[model samples]
Target: MRSTYILSFLRISVSVLFYILLVFSVLFLVASIASIAGNDKAGDLTKKSYSYRVKAFGLQNTNEPFTYSQDSMVKYQKVADEYSVVLEPSSTIGYYALIMKLVYMALGLVILWNFKKIFKETSFRQPFKNTIIKRLRTLAALFILSDVIKLLDYFLFNSYLHHSIASTKFQLLTDVGNGVITGLVILVIAVIYERGKELEEENALTV
Candidate 1:
């Protein structure tokens, strides 16, 4: 009975961890989208800057065959500004980035919900085999799905996108961490579920 209680405690702890990860993953998805959108707005502002009047101390002069002059300086500045603006970071990766993020978020939610269900069953002293197998299967599916989304996110956000090199690396690292922690939580839950099943079987045999 004490051992059973220990297993129950471990299972609940893992479930809590899974929930925490789910919340964090959702927050990250939101942040990523916001960041991409913010970049897009910045790029637009830069493009608009091209039309901005360049104010420099200069006397009115005639154009010298469009060669070196104040007019030329303004033109060159405008060109450079346009190029910089167009190249500025944004979620240019488009729908792909959004899709990947949604996938990951959905999977995380599923995993967390099922974990809560499993924890609730354990709290009610339900038989492990009957209650846990389905939950474990659900968890396994979510875990796999999360991994798939993570891989897609990596490729789309880092490879196809034009984000700053540092930001890309940071996003990849955070995604990897999320995946690893979620996977570990699932693994721990599986082990606890199996142990509960073994306990149930042993009790049956003794009875």
Candidate 2:
């Protein structure tokens, strides 16, 4: 009963998240089309804001001692260790970045759908099923592909920043290998499930 509740909860949560992402993806798709159709205003309006970790060089500390309250005085510098930049459709690289984002969203949607289907078809009583193994494999592939696309986006962003900015060096600080790791873990679990299903079948035959 508790597991039933948990599974239901998970299904609901994933559904909520999936719909939210789907809405955003649809918006992005429209924006992508607009960008492709020479709609600069629409492109600018729908441009996504991306954050990157920054490494600053030859920067001065502009923090001056100031007393905000008489009880406590504090000084702070107006410098950002990370920055968010919006990519527009002004150049070829920007278009590539946008297309990559669309691909990423598409993969993400498929991944979520797979998860939803798995959770729907799975039960605590029958956890290891053949259908789930296939879905898991599909999800794993999507995860790995999403990770690759992410890295490509990072490279594209890095290249864009390298040519655009001079003072501060921007780096993709987000963990890149998690998707592949997760995909591999799922593959292992699928193998385990396959073995479990075989043993279950063998037990059924012996009885």
Candidate 3:
């Protein structure tokens, strides 16, 4: 009874999260389309990156995406004056960046929805089934794919941002930690569980 209630709760919660993510995915898709439509000259821009307008001494992400010249000689009042005097050009790469972010979000939501279905299908009465094992394996592969896609996005962002700034190229030189490992572990578990199920069926038939 407790396990039944637990699974029911999990299914409900996961379904809610899945629906919320779906809404965001649709919004992102619309925003991506609107971006191209709104910016008529968006394709002509050479710099393929969204950048922070260096307002002060620090760098931070902002709604206003552009690159600008900075000066230490100017006063606070003069800063605003200078800002209006110069406007940094927008880039077409910003749209692609938004798409990358949306892809990441969509991937996470899809995995969550799959897990929701797994929980929904699970029953205390039926412990050994190939379907559950298959889902687990599929989820593991998705986990690894997610990490690879993330790495690709990071490389693309860094490359575009560097070109926009005329800065030295930076490479991310490290192994993907959590997602890869977790996926492998889940894969192993699924294999073992499937083998166990096979043995149980074989034993039942032998009698």
Q: All candidates' TM-scores?
A: 0.46, 0.73, 0.69
Candidate 2 has which clashing residue pairs, if any? none
lDDT of 3 at 62: 38
Residue-level lDDT tens digits of model 2 in 30-133: 86666567654644534343323554444554544453555556544545444565555545556666667688788888999999899889888778899999
The list of candidate 1 runs beyond 4 A from truth reads 1-92, 162-174, 181-185
**Which scores higher on lDDT, 1 or 3?**
3
Off by over 4 Å in 3: 39-90, 168-175
Ranking by lDDT: 2, 3, 1
Give the number of the best model, judged by TM-score.
Answer: 2
Candidate 1 deviates by what RMSD? 15.8
The lDDT of model 3 is 0.67
Query: 143-171, model 3: which lDDT tens digit per residue?
Result: 99988986887667556655654543333
User: What C-alpha lDDT does candidate 1 achieve relative to the native structure?
Assistant: 0.56
Choose the strongest candidate by lDDT: 2
Give candidate 2 regions above 4 Å deviation. 32-83, 163-170
